[model samples]
Target: MLEYLTSLNDHNLPYPDTIHPIVVHFVIAMVLFGFIWDVLGYFTGKTQLFEVGWWNMFVATIAMFVAIIFGQFEAGLAQPYSVAKSVLNLHTLVGWSLSGIITAITAWRYVIRSRNPQKLPIYYLGAGLILTLIVGVQVYLGDKLVWVYGLHTVPVVEALKDGLLR
Candidate 1:
């Protein structure tokens, strides 16, 4: 994914900025942390989390929308990168699916039961932790799709064309 994203450039002109990739990485990391929190709840016993109601789920789900915006924005600036087209499509599909599942699970307790998260029966935190790892894998896959494949001609290219690679 990094290879593909690194290959972004309309008219073969490399992007000359860095904000997009850094921000995208930051956001993805944050989202993963949220899932980690959920996973923590499943393991080591029913750990306590602030019953912030829908706010917790809301932010995580909304992050997906933000990621899509950044993704499309970067893609727009770096056209003709065929790898992005395919990865972007897959990314969007997986993101929406994950968000939907998260919402559904949260809603079951928040909306249907009309109860606070604290009142709901505890679930296995291992499931959530496993999911957190899975999310990381997805993000890594996106990176590989862009980088490993995009950098065939320029192996040292930074994934962030217009922004800081770090």
Candidate 2:
């Protein structure tokens, strides 16, 4: 599987496989979104998307872990564009940190949800707040990579240079 993953990381084009990094970006975004929405809903005395089906959030959180692994590899060593290695390293570190945060939050929430579903508002609120802040930081770091660190913007010359014809 490690070899398979390494081989798959090279096809950074826009094909099905090539688009995986983009999907990882989305997974990060969605996990943040879900966490934030749940937090806001809790404070406002409202019900959010994950408020009902905690199971789905668990599944998505797992998916986020997987996506982050793939994205980290691609961001570090995927072909062409040649993003700054340090910047992507920062991205990977931030991602792993978020995963840790999510795992801890998920565990705490699991205990809370199973104990008393109706009275879980307070516990959920705290978790949501922590998660929101973490995600917010992750988003900012991502933006920095894209704009300032050249992680997101690929030079056309590099793209063409990496093209098969070249």
Candidate 2: list runs displaced more than 4 Å. 1-21, 40-50, 53-56, 78-83, 121-123, 152-166
lDDT of each: 0.52, 0.59
Look at candidate 1 and tell me the lDDT of residue 32. Answer: 58
Task: Report lDDT (Cα) of residue 128, candidate 1.
Answer: 45
Residue-level lDDT of model 1, residues 3-92, one tens digit each, is 765665432334545344555565456555555555455343453542432355556566656666665565555432454567656765
Off by over 4 Å in 1: 1-23, 39-56, 80-85, 105-109, 112-114, 119-134, 150-166
TM-score of each: 0.55, 0.66
| RMSD after CA superposition, every candidate | 8.2, 5.5
Please report how far candidate 2 places residue 113 from its true position, in Å: 1.2
lDDT of candidate 2 over 1-166, digit per residue (tens):
5555444222343323534356556665666666665665565656544464365457557877777866765564443234445656766787887778777777776786778654456666666667777777767766665566543234532453467222
